[model samples]
Target: MRGNIIVRIEHDCQDLPPERRSDLVTRRLRFLSDAEILDLASRRERQYPGRNLHPVSITLPADVLERLQRLQGSRWSVSALIDRILTDSGKA
Candidate 1:
């Protein structure tokens, strides 16, 4: 998988725009050969085990979310807030 590696996932992302829920973006894409695809998968398995495979989700009242966002301002993201709560309560 040494020289077999060509375009990387990071490099692929670099050709695109930063992601935003409110904006549409396009990424430069290329067709990968089977060997390249296999290499990419293997590389990812080693590099980011369990990443995005399992995600936790929750639902809260719109007003509650809005209030929290206003209180925290730009200091915290909703994801970070949830992570902190879980950690603080030992649910993590």
Candidate 2:
């Protein structure tokens, strides 16, 4: 689990008030120790094989890079945002 794990919390907590979302995430995260999380994640990988990601380097003009960084915002990684763009355009 070297990369990101997008855990979409779509269970009973989905209907909770927006104000309670942070508390829910905090409580759920606190319930697992680092080692336990790693163990469970390893087990999951064994159970369901998925695509592996590798790093790629790309150079962009300063203005384009700045715009991409701004569009990335706080919720998404640059890689994720690029993936989304490609996927939406049927290129990924």
TM-score of each: 0.33, 0.35
Question: Candidate 2: how many backbone clashes?
Answer: 0
- Any residue pairs clashing in model 2, and if so which? none
lDDT by residue for model 2 (1-92), tens: 11222332112323344334333333333454544433333311234345454443333334334444343334445454333333333323
Q: What is the lDDT of residue 37 in candidate 2?
A: 32
lDDT of 1 by residue, 9-89 (tens): 221123222232101110100233434323323323246554442233344434333433343344334343333333333
Q: Indicate which candidate wins on TM-score.
A: 2
Candidate 2, run of 10 with poorest lDDT: 1-10
Q: Model 2: residues >4 Å from true position, as ranges?
A: 1-51, 71-74
lDDT of each: 0.30, 0.36
